[model samples]
Target: MKVDFRYLGRSEVREIAGGQALSFAPNLARSKVFFDAEIVHPLRFREAICALHDVVVGDLKFKKKDKGAYEAWKRDQAQKQEQVRQTLLDQARMRELAAVVKEPLPKNLKGDFQRMHRLYWDARNKWALELSRNDPELFRHLVPCDPVVTVAPDMVFFECFAKDESSYGFLGVDRGAFRTEAGAGLGTTNVDYSLALYEHFQTLRSYRPTRLLVDPSGFEVNIQGRTDYREEKIDLPASWLRGFGQLQAAMGLPSRRFELSVDVVYSILAFLKRHREKAGPRSLRFQLQPGKPPTVVLEPWGIPIVSHGRAYEGEKAEEIKVWGRRRLAPLARILPLAERFEVMLFGSGLPSVWTARMGEMRMVLALSGWTANDWTRGSNLDQFFADLQADPAAVDKLAGHLEQVRMARLTTLAEQTNVPRSVLMGSLHELARRGQLVYDFSVDAVRWRSILPVALSESMLGPEPAELVAGRRLAADPSTTVEREVMMARGARLVVANVGQSACEAVIDPDGSLTRAKCGCSFFYKNKLRAGPCRHLIALRSVARRSVVATTDRSDLTVHLMSGTYAELRAEADKRTVATGYVIEHAWRLAREAIQRTASLADPTQAAGVYRTPAKIPQSLSLPRALVEEIQREAARLDVSVSVVVEAAWSVAADQIRKSSSLLN
Candidate 1:
């Protein structure tokens, strides 16, 4: 039957196991096994507890003593119960349970409740299988076994039968036991415990545990919005959890992989073998002997000894903290989604013991955690390089984000590729000049703000047009439009002679050198290359058309030079050159001369002083009142400033009259 799986926390486990005082059922009987129409993993906890009860299990009883202590405990328990009741009452007041109980599990289905205990183990085993089979780079030596036993938050045991497989069949007297005619190899450490457990099961005639999965589905699960229940909440072995976290963190790098080739597996095994040699008893480091088979022997390091002194035939093995189990568990939930990958094995930060399976091959791998975050966080040089080569769009997006996040400087894009940062910087400069990408020193990388070419969003798709980018929109009376003004003020500046709204002229400073030049065009911005003027130019052309239509034609506005007028025009040209920093080039001078011959009159002085001035007469103030009155009366006769009246009224009046004549006349 299909049932949504969930992990059962300690509370639910305790409740179903019979709240502290409940005793195991008496006279428990063992039942014969039979294959069902549908075969599924049975809840092992119930079977184990029932088995213990059936065996008369040494009559389990509470060991806690001290009457006063018990009394205090009872009082605390009562207070806790009251608190729980109050909490439930509060929740009820909130009226949120209507949604919860609306589609609740069937009542009195205790078997379903018992199923939750299996979820944690199931997830772990399933995850292991997935990695072993799919992730050749991550789990090269992981092997599928006949029986997998799981005890939540602590142990997971997998067994493979040797010698006699029939004795280890699901049923009969030998039930689930491998009858090895030869004793288990001496010096085998944890393998002995597994073997012993297997042998004990045979004595009890119990069925083989094909795979022990702590199914969490049978629990009273209240978790909402969780599609993948195992990752939502899981209780895994502490060491395994740590390994999972490291794996997750490491797998984020898309380049990381557990190489599956036979040669790679053998090399990994060789690495592990060398590491195990010089490692002290229960210590985690090994020394590497150079020049011979690339030997790796352990040296004294920070590796810890977790479980020790339990080995078969006087051989001892310590439970090495392979990976940071605590840190890795959470990461395992997300590692598969990472963009890159790097394979690591036998490192100081890695798990002490790990078996990877690559197809038919199985071996151990080794690594040093000295430079681990690179492999773990998707910043691995190899991964970055590969991404740079294969998928530029994704790389650009990632780079842009990293730059935005201010990690671009820290990003070793150059190291990933042979390309130099100088070359990249030049390209970036060109792009920035073209207004394709903007660089902020406060930021780490160039930010991609889609300017110039309008982004086609859903809203834009439906709408006529939008003023989203930085530019001026031309009005119906285009003569008054400020497109040219806006471009001059906001766009990248061009060093040119005779720069005007129409027919702007400029020469490239370094001939044929396109590096520094930029065009304010949609194509230039979008493509990040210096191309000819695009849509912006077309738009400007439209604006120019309107200006031409609204303004007076300049065809007859010039004056031809004749004899004495030539000397005056020469003087005027000299003065214009000094004022504007631009001497007329040969062609421009010839064109100007031609235009002057065609024009009958010179261009007016652009309506001098268009700005309005104050109409009232001005007066200068003095500390003395008598001096101020004299100055005011003097200003009244000329209707001018006191300073103007005192300094030189005639000259000031002549200048004012010339300005007015220049303006209105």
Candidate 2:
């Protein structure tokens, strides 16, 4: 995805008589979203935006150890020590030479030395600043993309995905927090953000009257060829877009929601700051029981931070563990102003969202399962929406309704659309996946905000994983057998199966995720679940799922092309073409190859002269006069019989039928 940003001028803070004006230059290429309002709490807003900036620049991914780094460091240290010694010796000799000559230094020698030192420091600072201003590559390497800003009717929010691609931050300011002076449009756009702008944000204070402006006037002015008119093109990764959508979808799903006091969060942060763990099992274990305050047990140290907020009201007692605990450092900035913290835990080894509510403003930090397990590569999360087939009509209707209302709760949408709650849920998920809608956990409603101006489709997101594709193929094969499947506690299942030559065993959790898996294959041995599940595990899970699907009564299963079996059909086509018996066989081979390449099978009128002879079809279609004449002419031009051309057409049609009729039984 290539995103283009055209800004009239750089975003900056301008000093006024009694306040500051923070003007944000938005991307003109995006939909127009104008917002100009006086910030109610400038200091808190500054801290929150700065926290978002921290998230945007944060990269906690562990770097591989450089083999020669230690040696290089030692050499550099030795050189510095030698230089220092030489400098001291030279200074001592200069002092002795002066004493021998009996020529004393000037009275203002100390002042001269201090002045020279000040000049040198000034020059160095200027050079450093110039380098930062001139170097585009260095600046880009520092900031990946401008923070996405969306101005809704209800509130204004800024979203940013971290450079490591694991963490996501969203800061929302309610409409009540801003005194809107002007602007009527409401949409999402990118605001020009940089380290320099963040420095300007630090100047915000409670006494000063700070005005937050999206600067719609830039769009009004014509500056096509001006020097200040700047344009930037970013080759955005598809994985980044997918991660954004995945997090949005995950937020709307049912999760373990609880409130944690500010002091508990402070304790967790304090422990992390004091001690550094060097071993494994680094996680925050949440123990929740009915009528008891939630207790969070930090792993390895076994330190417990009990919450003093509300007691757990749910019936069952549950324990959930979340990793990537260190990413919570950014929350420390907002702690002073935040009233309370709300945590949403999807599940163990899944994403968790931590939101800090500060009166009218909220800052959300959504972390992936772990530092390395980014949302894009979390294949298990993708499985949750694999079976949710969105109805096109329902999606359009719901989108139309949401567009008019800006934001609405799920029940309100269901009541308005008169669509079933289940169907509407699927449609909303699909809308989020398409980047047309965002679920606002703060307000418990789905807001109409398009992440991208253009329409997004499934194809744009990227292709399915190779392991998933191969696994689906294996699952659809009748020869693949499930040896044993045992029911486990809490809706989990333990399954053992033979996938090809290897025996595989997997323990699936209640959420249909593989908690533990093992296989004889080398891929599984090498990567385990680090690179996602091996094909064997996926096949086993898919086969088990198909068995469950078979017993369920689903009337909505319509006849459609089973894309999974296309590979199988192509394989069979390859085998049958080895010893061709008739002209139809060659046509079938070509048709199958075309299907494999996802070519159009609607038109195959051209005569393929792989076979000289013609094959006849029983009960031939009675074509129109003009169409038959055209077919005859095409066959004649290609030096082939009419029957061969008709057979080629027939083969293509038959292949389409075969593809459409095949299903995962």
Candidate 3:
């Protein structure tokens, strides 16, 4: 599959030597990196990329923009807390120290109580010490710094590199037309010589970019422009496809999604920049009071930064915790240029997504709970599997709709197809992961992009971890059973899956992070849940989650999962208890209901097929009157539509004749 980028620039220019900066595949570690992003203005995007690069090198030094406000807020709260502490001491003295006149209160009591108030302020002060002061002379690794870049319907990936802890740089681009000259299912070559031709277009003084163009050919990549044209093969890694699918799985996971206006986003960014270093709180806490705009509480210091833009209209009162808050600094470059911003928090220390909406473009930053949960280390292997397989029927329907509209928002496509937003989102995500769907950030809709070869394996996303192999082996042993037990005593459903000789209990606190996690494994004992989950815990997480694979194209087929688990909305991780009778009864009832529902929607005019639905439409065949009358009689005898009666008779007769012919052969 060859794809090309055509330059819309107006000026004519002479060719020059290309720089070595843009060898995307060469610069990036293929095994470790794969993401997708779109840029509207190359220069502006270049600026943002440079800023992010500087941040990783620690060269873009920034003092907390809200330092003054933070300090004042800290002082004010401390004074108030001190007064409260004084009153509390007086009360203690009256209650216990009343008989002892010399000692008004316990000597340790005052000091301990005072320390409680300083928890907020002291943490704020420590933010500076916690900041990464190490300066890398060379960019070593782009672990937390990599951003996926795409040119809309076309493709362009820039992989930032680092030589040392401080040194890194790697990225590539198509310096021609965004349209493709080659067809899908072809090969692309990565030749560094394309740079010289790219320089040829850069010299075009009259060249003015009309808009970003992307002509995608599933196979090869061609760089076409007004003055220059080049062709080089591009390789689409399986993991790249899996990266999107895994992301969709996370998006479908249950989480707290909220909107933050540009101003509000800026305030939070500024707050973190100023106080995150000495900020008292390690976590960015969101106080979401029903009907009121969310109040962002700075860590440790307890300094409350209210939203200056939009209000929190959600009636549900929720408190959200976000870790790795400082990782969001890269967004500062684009947030100022964005029209809107939305944040999706998936429990504390889980993956949090920050989406900045530009008019026709979007910038998304998916940060793990910590910098260590890397894209390559595979902390989210479960998500990749869960999102890998999608409903083929939903995919077929979405493809048809996307073909007609070209691009549309999730809601629009969902409405057009009469499919639920959540259900369609699952299929779309799977399609996108399979490289069949191209996400258009400008329209905020997923576009129809076909597989170049028309067939690809799901395993391209890569292999499962060795830990899973061990866990699965233990789970399937005859002597052991990976039984899943659920309890809701603590308001959070607890899942326990036995592995080998020991078992692990895990509870995903709705607030984020495993609030109640205990495993007999030494990993858990040493880490105490801080270093991330053990392999055993990961296996049990799978058991706790249910799976559904659609078997047919019909709107509703006999959908039954193992153990007849209860499913969550857009979530797959919940499985309630199951009983034999309940399972049997529910299965029969749903099948019968689907049949009745299908019957009503079925059309009488459809051609003979296994299952095709359309409304009744009379047609003139101009057949013999005798045949027509006979057909009516047969239809009456069979008690079915005339079309069905005739079609069935013809089908049986044709089958008998074919069988007879086969005997002759």
Candidate 4:
């Protein structure tokens, strides 16, 4: 089969890297070549294959910059919460608080309730004290310091380090136990089922034995001929490790109990009964009206409700009590104020149960949505497995249009193409990473096909013409023209300081114009500007270039973090202007300059044989005054050239200090 290649624009080209480019290139021996004067075209089949390769390679293209930013944000949020904690500590009457109440009451509570506002704030913080204060969403649940713990199936525990008794540290577990079994195939168990019940005495001394959630279907207790034991036990899956730990942590506290009204409690039981009789998994979404003439609406996530009124109160109350006692006993102490709660059960699989604690009441939630395979229509092949499925031809055409408009999304393409949804999705993803196709989120399926750039079938059947190849090669070389030169200047600087092997240096003239540049990484030189530069280029340019600049004695060069234990320095850096290795080097150089001034004054020969007179080291540390004044006139310039004046003054002052001190001595 013959394969052709399509050229991408600057923005579209940037998404892919070198590996994808090579993958998209034709295998001249077996495949036929294709060429176009302005734009090259290849067969859709080969394009699809090349696109797939591109997608795979691109997926691995980790964006370190984005990752670093996300980590920094997490750190910043933690610090901000600490600040809030400190402010709260300054307030008096910190003790005897239940929960902090927020404004905009449940559209009901009367006048006297306003006094409890401060109490709400204290309770919210109390709940957060047990959990890590780093998470704000969880922290909100703490009313003034009252710990609000969320109990579920797979819970584990962690002890808090701080030990101030009144400081609101780890008190004790109130609800369920956290368990880990010792058997194979445990990893396949559902996350919620793996919870262990926590048994807390009035004291913190003795704990009880906990049972892990096991598959009811897998419960095989056969009678051996004689006195025989069971073969093996099962364990929880590795995937549930995090959920298990969190669930256990919730148990390490005194339980905050609430109750659902008798009517509301009865309604929950009726819904569960109907779901038990139903075929597949069933869900009920309900809204609770707290005050006068209380009413609850039982809404399902998908299936329509046949009857909304109360049922099973007289007839099924006993059965409900039995099941509720077995499953709801742990939560029995706190069921009175359950305003709006949801419960979900799986016929044969793992069941997840949860209750969200709002103010006095809690709303329980369950995972009710169907699995991916259930939604997939294998024969239809056109619609996607998401909430909405569209026509296949429409999806492919949409994919084609996204390619023309230079958007990226094979999943969306599959939805549009109506081809086997999975195949189109996989293929579209391939094209996007290879930088051959693009996508836009704005358009519908019909409009998507309209946007793609047109490629004729005939244009993709042969070798690329010599003229086009030569032009492309020329475009890659930045030294060829002013436009290319400017583009390389910007890209070179961007990659110079990245954590990569390639390093490029740009020379700025006195007028602040980029005069000349060179990059050893070879990316910019090779005429490619996609997927940023490799890590090697970043290291060479950033680490190596900064090293060179440090030696240059430039006044603007700052010291920064090169390498060290983060914990040892993180606290100090927060207080004293934290920066990278480059900034740290700059600070050191400044100090060294001060030392040099003292040294020169102490030397007889350097001091011109005069005891108090200081010799000068002439250095033009800043640009000329005219250049500075010119930049000052431009509002768009980020940096003004006034730095020269500051440098000159600092140099003169250093000499003056040396002379005065020498005279005094």
Candidate 5:
């Protein structure tokens, strides 16, 4: 309820805040440190929070849950494993039972005397706090250097997560580094009291203090705009508040938006200082086109460099490739107070959206992949966005385009909401996940930000109506969906499939601006309606947006989005629902034995019962990506199901196409 941070003082804005005194791996449950103060950014937001906390999901282990389901949850426990092992040895605690080690009870004690020593002391205190947080030579210097602030009366949102929240660290701060105070306000503290309020805002950021008086009744609440701020509120997850509006709308999946300069970031920090032991798929690859310029390459010596300095206008010639190129070394320390360094790629391992700018300040960073993908796989920002559906008429025309301009250009609210600037960019990422909206980065537009604090309410920014979670998941179950109808001539079409596949379709639009509202989902071919309509097209367009579109012709309906061909839309929705059973006569007897074994294959991959009769017209082939990763690593090394090793390699290519079509007829 009280705040201040006025400082012009600027000694490297307090020794460029890389302040150290943080700690959390006392087996993570700390994060409450809300105000170890001082924050103002200018050194590329603390080297993009130490290059996204040097993306460390490192050395995690976990996997112990299944001593045969904890001996079948202790043989159905009615209670008695020595009377709950004497109530977990009298609520143990001689330093948590000498930090655990008694493991001899399963000598075939056919488990079932309840809470088996409280599930073996909660899996031995979660394997001794994941072996003391994966000891990188002794708990790798703890790290959660607590930063999850939120101050707002004009923006100040910081975030950090990883000790396996996969990886993320955001920063917002901006309202010219907010300053104001009257009564009292200062309560969140940790990380050695935020490095002692960044050593008293490093004497006003090592000297930029033109005037300073951040007095909330004084004890130092410093802020000299060069960056080291703190003010937190940890433990926030609803996918980290919808990853602050879907990971800053991953620069709306760029078809290439390069800009570079600052000498292509010192020629990528002199190719990571002459390839410091470069053993990687170490990419940076670019090669885009249109007007041409962005070459990059430096990968396993495919070399290429180019760019006299940013230029890939991109309309076509693409190549992208961008692996965590050393997490853009925190934009090379603000590329000498940057003047342009944007990037928005979407290729190799996904998620990469940098941007620097600096003048009026702008500092984005998204990253998501590399650092051996946090040791091979984990941070996939849940495929960014797929189950969309938030368009309360595009949040009432983005609250009437931020009440007529205070910022909003997605082509001026898709030309004042006739809607379709790729579906008003998922209704401006669902109004930037309900704090109504924000995202200026020095006017890259999207305003009506937030400042909510009169003791914070607006449903604490969590479930901002996406049709109340697709109507409480269609009222909890409603047989997990399956609607289908599709006749077309403009009237009877529905298709809803959820019990296995073919999910999404409901056309005969009475009102829903149904662009053949399809849904076969891969998040609708990666953000088509621009990520905002796929919960079976938001439950069949909220039942066709409550019927009333009177001038029909949504391209004569029947678009049917993706994941389809579900046994030919369930044998055409079982001939208009209910007639031929045995699952549509066993899916038309495997589609007439896959059309009489590839009906004279003129070249269905040079024939082989045309790849084993699994259909009548269910033809969709594209295998060899190194044989689908060797049939997905031999279906996870024979644990099975790469559709049973691709239908047993199409039953040995349908027994070598019935012995080569009986020696060619």
Candidate 6:
């Protein structure tokens, strides 16, 4: 994708009577966005912006040793030898010429040559420095894009992705922190940023007053003859867009959230600065338990740094390990101003977010699994969103609504749209994946912030993995059959499936991570999960998901039939009726009539309560034999009829479903 940025003038900090004015020139090619505010905490803002700049230029990937260095060394040695030989030859020739012609050579010839050589080098160095000053782009080839700034009603934030695509930064200043001077427009636009601007930010101090401006007046002024007018056109790679989307999506997923004191962060950084590891298992392990402070154990050396923050309120104990600890260096500078650090860990070998909180400002640093495992190439993280089927229409509807509100919680969005929370979640994920929205973990709400002027399309995210594509095809084929599924303890499942010509078996853990997989295909025999799951494994997973969905639908129907009112049961049964061609309503009517006829068989008082038609619906359901026997035993123990036991069981199941679904909100 090609993006064009035209700035009226370079962003600079200008001296005023009592303070400084920090003016930022935005991309005029995008929407006209402007904000002018008097900064309450200039030093904090400056450090946060400087930290963002560090992320913009940071590249931590290990580079191989360059062969050109050795070549240059060889050339230097050869040149020295040639110079020595030439000097010897000249001296011998000079002796012979002195014996023959006896004319003295020019006295100042060697001195003059030396002077000329020094002058030439000095002039060349000056020229190169001048050229670089004239064209800053020559030095910024790696940073193809600039930081994105969004001005919303609640706050203003700047977002940037690292050149290496391994780290992401978000710095937000709440509106309460800034006193608006002028211009209330709200939108997202690129700002002109450079190393020069970062240098200017260091001059900010608490003693001096500073005004922050996202200057839109640049768009109004004529730039026909302006000397500072400049334009840049960058052809951004697809991986850049894909990485941004992936990181945004990852932030919205459920994670283990905790808080750390500023002192704890300093301790971690201190240890990292002193020691260097040159071995395996370089990770930061988090030992968490309910009602206890978290302990962070540094790997390879087993050093522990316990936090002094509040106790963990999670239900269970867990140990999560995260990599890419070195990327936390950028946060060291802003530590003094930060009050505390909030961290969200998705899982071990997954992305994590660390947020530095000031009074009303936050600096967020999101790192991938490791330096080499960038967001774009993390297939394991990508699998989380693979099965999420997003409805385009619903996504558009939610996006339009969010645009007007600027920011909202998920429940608020669902209530307004009148759509199911599950479907709305998929839509919200779709919006986030396209870079149209950002989930703010601090507030647990989503804000409208478009990373690009235009929404990224599916093509811009690159193609799906070849294995996933082939697996989808196989799953859709009629020949593919799920042979057996054995329910194991602790929500685990053992699945066997015949995909194409191969028989595959896979063990899926409770958390959906693949524990074991085997297949007869050559792809599996060669690379196995190193190159991701084979097509057969993917097909088996797909078939297993379909089977689970089918079972869930039946279970949901049973819950509705036993506990729901007449109207609710009719609505749910009508949906199943369409698919199975069963006259569910007529079946219910016949069952009710049969129960009335058999009223004489039971106690007259109990029969009146069992045959009530308002709350309970008596419909024939094919339940598991074990469940039926359990219900019978419960009824016998309670000294009640089977109908009463069924109704009580449905109420419990419905309550559990409601509780589980509340987690999504």
Residue by residue across 406-470, what tens digits does model 2's lDDT show? 88887678888887765666687778777778777777788887877788767787887777788
What lDDT tens digits, residue by residue, belong to model 1 across residues 351-419?
Answer: 222233211111222221322221112111111011112233433544455334422342564554344
Task: Report the poorest 10 consecutive residues by lDDT, candidate 2.
Answer: 554-563
Better of 1 and 2 by lDDT: 2
| Pairs of colliding residues, candidate 2 | none
Listed per model in order, the count of residue pairs whose N, CA or C atoms clash below 3 Å is 58, 0, 77, 100, 32, 0
* C-alpha RMSD of each candidate structure in angstroms: 30.1, 18.4, 22.1, 33.1, 28.7, 11.4
TM-score of each: 0.18, 0.69, 0.47, 0.17, 0.27, 0.72
> How far does residue 46 in candidate 4 sit from its true spot (Å)?
67
TM-score (C-alpha, index-matched) for candidate 6: 0.72
* Model 6: how far residue 40 lies from native, Å: 0.8
Error of 2 at 312 (Å): 1.7
Report lDDT per candidate.
0.27, 0.72, 0.45, 0.26, 0.45, 0.72
Give the clash count for model 5. 32
Off-target runs (Cα >4 Å) in candidate 2 are 66-73, 76-143, 252-254, 418-426, 457-459, 481-665
In terms of lDDT, the poorest run of 10 residues in model 4 is 375-384
Model 5 has an lDDT value of 0.45
The TM-score between candidate 3 and the true structure equals 0.47
List the candidate numbers ranked by TM-score, top first. Answer: 6, 2, 3, 5, 1, 4
Candidate 3 C-alpha lDDT tens digits along 181-235? 2222112222221224334333323223322212222113333432223222233
lDDT of 5 at 436: 50
